[model samples]
Target: MADRVASDHESITTVRATLARRGSTSRPAIELPDEQSSSSPDSASSRRDADAFPAGEVVRLVVDGSERHAKIEEYAGDRSIPGAYDAPSMARDPDSASNRLVEWADDKGLELGQSVLVDVIEEGFKYGVREPGERVFYDATEAPDDSLASIAQQLEDN
Candidate 1:
């Protein structure tokens, strides 16, 4: 392997020169990344297949410090926690909040297609957090104009 550092390249060049002096006609081929993907350093995964989601469902999108937005399913849609959810007894389970929020949203007419930002700690009161709180997002559909992004933008701009 040839290093790109000037010091290493100098040594490799010297060696190749020495081989050429021996009347060797062979040449080593240098390989580089495909030109199409040179823009991104981590490009391999860019070509990988992703899970296909069902169309026409309203999906809740949560955007935070991270660039990615987590999607949560909306009404008629439900996320189930491992134990029975009572909201009053959640702090024991870190993820119990999701089940409770989905339930609460259901009762509040925020059905399957609604997107929401939920305080994981509060929802997990039955399993509340010991320290700070965690925020999770839920989405359940694919309509852009009616998506969380558009709704949030409309809300924010207004």
Candidate 2:
């Protein structure tokens, strides 16, 4: 445990030093672990186990022939809910705000009385309304300029 803590401390110091030297013309290169290495911090397993959602991140889910979006208040193991969304504005009904998953399903003509396949479009949010499965994709280029993905990218670039 002591060794692990020391390693963590060293990693933090390295990250801080890198950040502090960001603008220097001769800033030292920070070597990243190989992508093929499972032990890499950037490994898929580590990221999934880590906090998937930071503030302002929303999960987009595609279920059946429709999509939905939700804000996951917390992560519960490897579970996730997937769907679609509108940037900035969410299609919400005042009476069903607390049950947006059902609302979205109903609005999209998805029948809750039957089994459905739910695939995650992105990480960090969930609103369970179907059986969770592997990651999926949609044409995000159609997303608005003020989308969560765009905002996250901008934040990272800064």
Span of ten consecutive residues with least summed lDDT in model 1? 13-22
**TM-score of the candidate numbered 1?**
0.17
lDDT of 2 at 88: 18
Candidate with top TM-score is 2
Q: Point out where model 1 deviates above 4 Å.
A: 1-84, 87-102, 120-158
Tens-digit lDDT string for candidate 2 (1-158)? 13212112222111100111112432211111112222322112221233433333555543333445544322333222322344313422122234344444565454423333322222344311232222223333123445876887576556
How big is the RMSD of model 1? 27.1
- Supply the global lDDT for candidate 2: 0.31
CA lDDT, every model vs. true structure: 0.22, 0.31
After superposing all C-alphas onto the true structure, candidate 2 shows an RMSD in angstroms of 18.8
TM-score, every prediction: 0.17, 0.30
